[model samples]
Target: MSTPPASAGTGIAASRWRHLPVGALETVRGNLEDALLAGLLALPVTFAAAVLGGLVGEELMEPSGPATTLDLTSRASLAAVAVLAVLGVLARGLVIALRGVLMARALAAAVRAGTPPTEVPAPLQWQHAHERSDRAYRRTAIILLVILGLCFGVVVPAAVQEPFLSGLAIIVAGAAVLGLIALGIPLTGTVLRRRQLALLGPVDGHWTQAHRIIAAGHVLTGDAVAAARAGRPERGHPGSAARRLGKVATAVVGVGATAAYLGFQVVAALAFPDRQRWAGGLPGERADLGPEAERMVDLAVTVCVVGGAVAILALVVGALAGLAERTQEQAALRRALVEGAAPPPYPVLQRYLRRRSAPLLRMVSALVGVMLVVGGTLVVLDGVVDAPSWGSFAGAGQGLREATGLGPGILGLALGVAALEVALASLLEARERRLRDAVVQRWPVRPAPGG
Candidate 1:
């Protein structure tokens, strides 16, 4: 093999060895800050999980009837909730840990990119960076805590007391929180930028370029790290194939389970009219659904089933596509490394960072979509089946309320709230991606010499 150039070796040595301590320290500080933020972000989820777990636990332990045995559907619901609660707890911790690792890699790559080949960054420079990051993290955590406290402590409790208004209150509270976060991002970035300029004397475009290089390095490193963690198949690695197969199997199982649950609900609804009470209808009363109403119900159920299947299929396809993209990203990273060139700009990295809990977010979105479909279907059925019997607008309204009760009403409200959340998230993500792309273009990374 031909010997590498002296400058190339020196740069590698400096980044890998001489400046390793600075990078390591920065990584630790960043991870600590991120951990705090993660914990704060998890508070609402933890609360929800705890409440769900408690409810499910109580239901499971209580006697269902004279035989003390629960029906399969009741048992399934309780079990599913319990499992979700446990998974939520586990997923929280796993995400935090993964974020820590990602931060470590990003910080290391950033330190390497920011530091010149001839000089390691001064300890004071690292200290300044740490302070800026710490301040941002602390402010975010404080704001999140305050928002969560207010929503859960005051808003939720007050709303719960009013049976008629609780759903509305929950929706409003959720939207308010998402809106606040959306507003906070740009505001926080502006404040931090000003703070940076104040702390470090105004400099030429080089300073801005260096910051951009560091950011690009972070993004590239994060992509590489995430791709590596994805466990793509490697040549001569038989076990990698098995792992990839296992991942596919897991996805398939998840889709199947969701389909099974939805199918069970539909079958029960059609077969056991008395059990409609569980879905907020009156017990022991026949819906007396006419042929037209029955056809509508069938159509609604079929739509729900098909909609759910499509959602799951979309999720699976997305996952597979992501896996393939990650594999390509890894190859690109390797090529960039070998050729000493900057990787192509990847705007998705910005979106990925913003959506750290993407899997969870997607799941929730799917669930909300399902809820909307089911709830709307029930509302339509109520108006169709009962409105004719009641024979007047006022009577129809009362009949609709009595038939659907609080269940579908809450689901409908939740769907509305979720729509707001999705809109806000998309807007913020697009803005962030644009900002990141602008930064990358303005301060493009320089290619290394002697590639």
Candidate 2:
């Protein structure tokens, strides 16, 4: 074999090194943007929860006493709820609209980059896949509805008075439902694959419309990355100014609501409750304010806590979305390099390898770190501080039990569940890496001179 020129080899190596950092930085920036967007989208949920908490707080502090039914007849309460509801709905709508705008921009960028159209499977095969997907969805929905009805409508209502029992029931039911869904996913995928193979003949490997769509998405994403790196500006659509204004307005509402919620929590904790009423008594045991005041306080605190939990969940989802995006990019680059097809830019390839080697390990490590930090913090706080009867932390456990029937045991259960998830994810990640390595090794690399 003839040796390539030294200059050519040097040029290739230089090109590979030149944009590697830029590409990786771009990937990280994209992930952060995705996470922030996801968190923004969840603001409405948090706002709604805050509003509910506020209403509950008002009822607790009401002069007439807590009503069995919400007093929607009260003008002040009704107006406040209505206003908050409208704001939440508007915020949600704007977020969705902004998402659409971003998607349009992405599509335009993909088109400008000359990304190829997605491949379409044969009509019969497509139809079969569609039918199978629909059937699976419907079946899953029905099972979910049945399980929810049994748990919430029957079991939960029966144990409503017993907070611990009801909370445990909810947790158990939720876990079982999640496990069922998880198991069903793989079984469904297997069935779909077998059916496809039977129809397309065993010689034809697994291919489906979903796979085609995913492949197309990867291509578009790759093109977008390339265009971004090349400094090509994405053309704005008509009404861009209006969309920008809408986004601004929505953001204002979301931020204002979130701040207001936090303020309420602070004020309610420090100034609202009468600490003297419950002095020398266990939290929620004294009826100094009213018979139902302590109960209402617990309910309000529970709602706020739940809202905080939801916010955290939203951020987690955003992080996952970013991870998924990076994974797709890595896969696209790997396949291209291995197949000797149109390989991505050298920088992108370098970026992929830099990311791919240790994502799962990093994720697992992060999870463990978080677990340790949280556990240690809780242990330290429990030992160092004696909780006041009227303090914010006071009656928190009772509040949780009142609201969800969950006791302190729920904390341990949550940690256990998280640990299990980390373990499972690590195993799956390892298996995936092994499979990808096998494929890469099997195929001879065909280097493309340029991206």
Best by lDDT: 1
Candidate 1 local lDDT, 1-451, one digit each (tens): 1112212444323231111232333333333333333333333333333333332332224433311211221222333343333333333333332332333343345444664433322222333343333234335445554655565565665666677677677867776755654464444445544544443432222234444333334323445534543654333321234346547755764675465446435534654577645543443443566776556545544544444455445445554544554444434444444554443334332322222322334444445544443354344444444445433323224433454554468666855766555554454444433333332232222222120
Q: Taking the candidates one at a time, how many backbone clashes does each contain?
A: 0, 2
Candidate 1 residue pairs in backbone clash: none
Give me the runs in candidate 2 sitting further than 4 Å from their true place. 1-260, 266-303, 343-366, 378-451
| Model 2, C-alpha of 400: deviation from truth (Å) | 16
Q: What is the lDDT of candidate 1?
A: 0.40
Candidate 1's C-alpha runs over 4 A off are 1-75, 90-286, 346-451
Hey, what RMSD does candidate 2 come out at? 20.0
What is the total number of backbone clashes in candidate 2? Answer: 2
lDDT of 2: 0.39
lDDT of 2 by residue, 345-372 (tens): 4334433333232333334433433332
